[model samples]
Target: MAKLLFGSLAWFSFPSFADNKPLNSPVDYLSVLLSLVVVIALVFMLGYIMRRFNVTQQGGGQMKVVGSMALGTRERILVIQVGEEQHMLGVTAQNINHLAKLDSPLEVAQPSGDNFKDKLTQLMQGQKGKTHD
Candidate 1:
């Protein structure tokens, strides 16, 4: 009874491999590495193809967002350029409202002289001064 039980346990403990190769062989590792590289390459290739075809792009036709500002947690003002004209719109979670049409579109100002970190430090200092007063 002891011999039979030990034999059955030993048979179950070892897995049966059809190829008769060691589990951690170089060929297995090479195959796994090749498969990972192929999968990563395929993903990047698919992304490039989609971007090239504009399949995953937003607002590429006639309308473009010129500027936007958030008024509240759920409300925002957007300046969108359509064809040759620009329109201001009030956007909320529930609805969108057309505000006005501007003769010239708002141009984004380029930061000069100070870098972002310096500007941020100045803004923090200004806010602190305002709070003290």
Candidate 2:
């Protein structure tokens, strides 16, 4: 009775204790191929959906700010304006700081005396202090 109970427990634990089969079987290979095809098809479908939604640009070449990085203890922000978007990345102290100042750029000054980048930074920092979205 003890041997029977132990055998029953062992069987329950080792459910896959059946015939030994090669992992690299034709069925497995076919399944892998099918999965790869499905993934590729899904990727194509996503691209199509993005195009339909206008999330991605249609034309090949558009003015895009490649990289913009900030540095220093002051967290002096460096922003790069692309076609219609801006990017803010992080930079090390070793990186050179080149301020691109456009003279007479703004026709009307901001009431807060801060540019777009400064306002964005302030907003982002404020978000860090509070939990509410």
In candidate 1, residue 105 scores what lDDT? 72
Local distance difference test, each candidate: 0.75, 0.53
Off by over 4 Å in 2: 1-22, 57-133
For candidate 1, the per-residue lDDT at 65 reads: 79
Please provide TM-scores, in order, for all candidate models, with all chains considered together. Answer: 0.39, 0.27
Candidate No. with top TM-score? 1
Residue-level lDDT of model 1, residues 18-122, one tens digit each, is 344676876666765776798799999999987565463346689877787889988999998888899999999999999999976787444473655569989
Residue-by-residue lDDT tens digits, candidate 2, 38-66: 87999999999875554633233554334
